[model samples]
Target: MDLNYSPYDFGIHNDPYPVYARLREEAPVFRNEPDDVWVLSRHADVQAALRDSATFSSVNGLRIEPAFWGPDAERFFSFVAMDPPRHTRVRGLVSRAFTHRRVQELEPRLRELARAYLDPLLDGEPFDLMTDFAGPFLADVISELVGVPEADRGEVRRLGAAIMYRDEESTDLPPEALQAIGALVGYYAELTRERARGRRDDLLSGLLDAAEGDDRLTLEEIVGVAILLVGAGIETSMLTLGNAWYAAWRHPDQRARAFDGRVADWIEETLRYDPPPQALARTTTAEVELHGTTLPAQSRVLLLIGSANRDPRVFPDPDRFDLDRDTGSSLAFGSGRHHCLGANLGRLETRIALEEIVKVVADYDIDTDGLRRIHSTNNRGFATLPTNVTARR
Candidate 1:
């Protein structure tokens, strides 16, 4: 467990699976310099830490480099930065709105949305599937679900990109990122106000209702939670959709299964092999020991989720993408109290998206000429996915 392994090194910000595997083998609890963070790379280790919230607290911060706007930014985003009890309270309210049944009920609507957005692109020649299909589709779903007016989806999406894409290393001054954050916060506040009329049945309405209860959410809390949900919901799904398409196009056999309604396994396999979320970070609120290393209070821990997902101990031939493989349970959605609440929703979107893509893309080729990776400490995804798709009919 060397103290010199930097995930930021090895060109990992672009792609880090190889480095992750090396870490798992050499330093399961590798301490990364540059960021002064300890990384947990093994599947079992990551899963255990995720479940053991007491040892590895998330309260201090869940993000790698805390936002530039002081601790208020952290406190405002308490739902994401809080631990157990409080986290459970706020998350429960939102989770109630996104129940399995609700997501399942939304499947047909999602499929319809997918076709409406993609069929035209499919009819035309080559196009960027990420922009044409995934991005728009995810934005539409999140906008509608969050009670944002259909007319405002474009503005919402623009703000979403600004907030989600802005990174610690973003050349734009901190003020620019803060400006983007403010605009999004303003929009969410307005949306909350609108949802307050009690005239909607979407998730936003549910959240507003929950906010009015005894253990109610503060106005800032409501706004922050809304911003997180709106941004996280859409961006994560967009990443999943992009990665799903990439996997199908790369693995033809898996792509064939996807078209035939037997691709859930493939989707699961892809999630295991290349999770949209590469890492999850937690801060130690109290001194704790991990893998013989003492993580002092206030120390940061980065769980290399992508590496854990590909751990050979858990997944045989972990690097290979096999639709038929039996991946018992993967770290794609993470594990523990903070495991992704929208995992089922993400799966539903991916399954239907691939189904529709298969129906249209008889043959497709990834235009690897110029693909860009989203620069971020946590989420692993593509910024732009170029593809040449052929019509099935």
Candidate 2:
């Protein structure tokens, strides 16, 4: 085992695909100290582990550092911490909300919301695509879905950013941040009770009804799932939006093809090339052998989802972002039992955002001078992207 690459101290935050490529080739399962965890870099290994939940459990929580969960770490780590029957039960209930009918119903409204934000941002002068458009677009959509008032959306965005910070040193959330999470949880809990009491016609109401039996999700579970859904929704979708715009501006030919119904494929390529959730953690429930190394029970396995997506074994010319190439099963969304229940919703969000942007904004350029990455091990995205966009004349 050549002990050369420093997985913890990866300097190239701007472009980490190269590092992931190296890890996949040399040490498929690399160990690092910054987070003090073992990273699985190969696609096959990560995929297998994701599918085999019995060996690799989500119980220890998905974050590398415990602080990523902030104050509600214990009280809110339900959906992400459950295994087997419990995991299936909770996920199934939430899955009902995002079913084809519900999401399809939400599409027209979602597109209207996209246009509402996009048109304002597309006014004459240069605007930051991320702050002015992507961020607000996603934040607003999630807010509307969870019954958040339009006025409170900013505060929600603020707290969401603070709580989703990736840098291990970012635990100092202002009082308002805590309040934001509490308010969100309180709102959802009340909404859950309301849906339970009176048969409402919304998705939240359906989830509330789903929590009735012995396998019923607890109030805490309801709050946790709501928080997870809302937080995860805004962050990842916004990241995809920003990344897609960046990818398009960088590749002119690709952008043209992307506009022609190939944006979904392009988004898939972007995810494989540079996913928002760069890496994920799973605690081993039993001794497991991966790549000739014996991982003891309870040992944490850090799946480098971005790395796996770029593994040469799985994708030919893995580094190249070819929209036509059928890159098999990228772990942009997690695999197996605990896979993202909001996968379809996330895709719809990204697709609609791209469609709106591509149609309204003609010329674009990345303002690399001030771009910043969110500081979180669990979620990878930009905090501030100072880009200039020209609306179609």
Evaluate all candidate structures by whole-model CA lDDT and list the values in order. Answer: 0.73, 0.73
Residues 1-393 of candidate 2 have per-residue lDDT tens digits of 444433244244456777777788778877675556788888999999889989888776777555443323534456766787777777787676557677666778789988998787765666676777777788777766665556767877776665544443352444555666777777778777876777655666666667435556677776787788656788788887777777776788887798766878888888777788877778888888777887888777788888888888888888777888775678989998878877788888898888877787766777788777765555566776776777787
Best by TM-score: 1
Candidate 1 has what TM-score? 0.90
Please identify model 1 stretches exceeding 4 Å from their true place: 1-4, 66-78, 165-177, 211-213
lDDT of 1 by residue, 22-59 (tens): 88877887776677888899988899888888877777
List TM-scores for all candidates, in order: 0.90, 0.90
What is the clash count for each candidate, in the order shown? 0, 4
- Which candidate comes out best when scored by lDDT? 1
